[model samples]
Every structure is written in structure tokens, then in C-alpha cells.
Target: MAKVAIVMGSDSDMPIMKKAAEFLDQMGIDFEMTIISAHREPDIFFEWAKGAKDRGVKVIIAGAGKAAHLPGMCAALFPMPVIGIPMKTSDLGGVDSLYSIVQMPSGIPVATVAINGGLNAGILAAKILATSDEKLLEKLEAYSEEMKQSVVEKAEKLDKVGYKDYE
Candidate 1:
């Protein structure tokens, strides 16, 4: 039973969506990933979204370009946190997808990330789950510390080498 479901409308989204999977994996979060187009195959998509909760999926990270309905649809049917990753499209550079996701109507809400922000979507889902799990929350804290340490190290190196000579 996966705690997270990472779905995308097209396989083309795999590159961006996989960042979410990788981050989830790093956080020791179990996740199931799949490609299901809401437009081309509404029946399958509907079934998957409707049954996700029953299948033990607590969070959904949906990536889609263009109209980007996958995340909103999951929000409508799953009754859980749905994070949307707006893919960069050739047409409008993903502004269309981003708007479609971020501008949800009253009740139904899909928490959206920046364009191609797969890693952030995964982190957000983990944080949402952490709210109920102390162990997970501790892990998230450690993760934050690691990130802070990384930046500190980089800043130290920049200070030592100076910005002009820093790698």
C-alpha cells in the first residue's frame, strides 16, 4: 500500500514527475507512480482517482501540461492533498497549466507548485504527511538541516575562494 500516488497525464511528464518519486524515495515514503491521461482515457483516470484513497494513497502528486486537469481531477475525487506540477509546454511555457491548477474554484483545491517543480511537490506531500507522524516530522527536520548545512558549506567555500574564483 503506497502512501503517495505520483501520476501524470502523459509519459512526457515522466522526467519532471520522477523528481517527485526520487525525493519521496529519499524520504523513505512509499509511492506508486503511473501515467494516466484524463482527456484520452477519462474512465481509467476516474477509476484510479476515485479508488486512490481506498488503496491507501494519502497524497497525490499530479504532473500535466497544457490544460493540466489531472491534479484538479484528483483533488475533486480523492479528497486528499493533491500537488500539481505544471509542466513547461511549448505553447504558453506552462502558464496555462499553472493557471488551470492554481485557480481552482471554492471547495475543490489543488495545492500547486512552480512550473516543473517536481521536487517541491514531493517535499510538500511529505510535509503534509509529517503533520500526523512524529517520526516523519523528525526526518523532515533532519532533511531541512541537511539542506541548510549544504548551503552553509557552499557559502563558506564562496567566502574562502571569493565569488569570482568559486566553482
Candidate 2:
């Protein structure tokens, strides 16, 4: 049973949404991914969103560009946490998509991240799930330590090599 549902409006979002999947994989979180356009196929999307909870999906990470209704629609139908990733668009540089997800009406809230922020979305989803699972919480803590160590290693190299020699 998947705890997270990773959905996007189109395949073009694969590049961005893959980051979320990669992070979830590292955290040992199971997720079901699919491309479902809320506008083009409302019936299918609606059914999927409504049945997500029954299917064991506790969180949803939705990526969409342009109008970006996928995330908001999922939030509206699914009674769980929804994290929206606004893909960068060539037209407005994803401002349109960002606004659409963030400006959701009262009583319906979609937690949105920056344009193309799939990794953060995945981390946020993991944090939400970790509230009830001690093992997952420990994994999250170790992940944070790993990230901190990576930065420390980079900083040490930069200090030793100096800015000119660092690459």
C-alpha cells in the first residue's frame, strides 16, 4: 500500500517529479505515480482523487504547469495533505502556476512549494508521515544529518582549496 501519491498533469513534469520519487525512495516511502490532467480528464482525475485515501494514500505530491489545477483539485477532493509543485513555464516562468496553487480558496488549502521544488515536496510529505511513525522519524533525522555532513565536507574542501581552486 502506497502512503504517498505522486501525480502530475503531463509527462513533461517527469523531470521535476522524479526528484520527489528519488527522495521518497531514499526514505523508504512507497508512492504511486501517475499523470492525470484535471482539465482534460476531469472524470478520471476526480475518481482517482476520491479513492486515494481508501487506497492508503496519506499524502499527495502533485506537479503541474500553466493553469496548474491538478494540485488544487486533488486537495479539494482528497481529504489529506497535498503538496503542489509548480513547474517552470516558458511563458510566465511558472508564476501563473505558482499563483494558481497558492491562491486556493478558503477551506481548501494546498501546501505549495517553489517552481520545480519536487525534492522539498517529497521531504515535506515524509515529515507529515513521520508524525506517527518512529522509524520514519529516525530516517528523517539521519537524512538531515547526511545533508549536514555533505555541506560540511564541501565547506572543508572550499576552505582548504580556496575559492579559486575549488570547483
Per TM-score, the best of the predicted structures is: 2
lDDT of 1 by residue, 61-167 (tens): 99999999988999999988999999999999999999999999999999999999999999999999999999999999999999999999999999899989998
Q: Name the top lDDT candidate.
A: 2
Per-candidate TM equals 0.98, 0.98
* Residue range 34-96, candidate 2, lDDT tens digits: 999999999999999999999999999999999999999999999999999999999999999
TM-score between model 2 and native = 0.98
Deviation from native of the Cα of residue 15 in model 2, angstroms = 0.5
Give the local distance difference test score of model 1: 0.95
TM-score of model 1 vs. true structure: 0.98
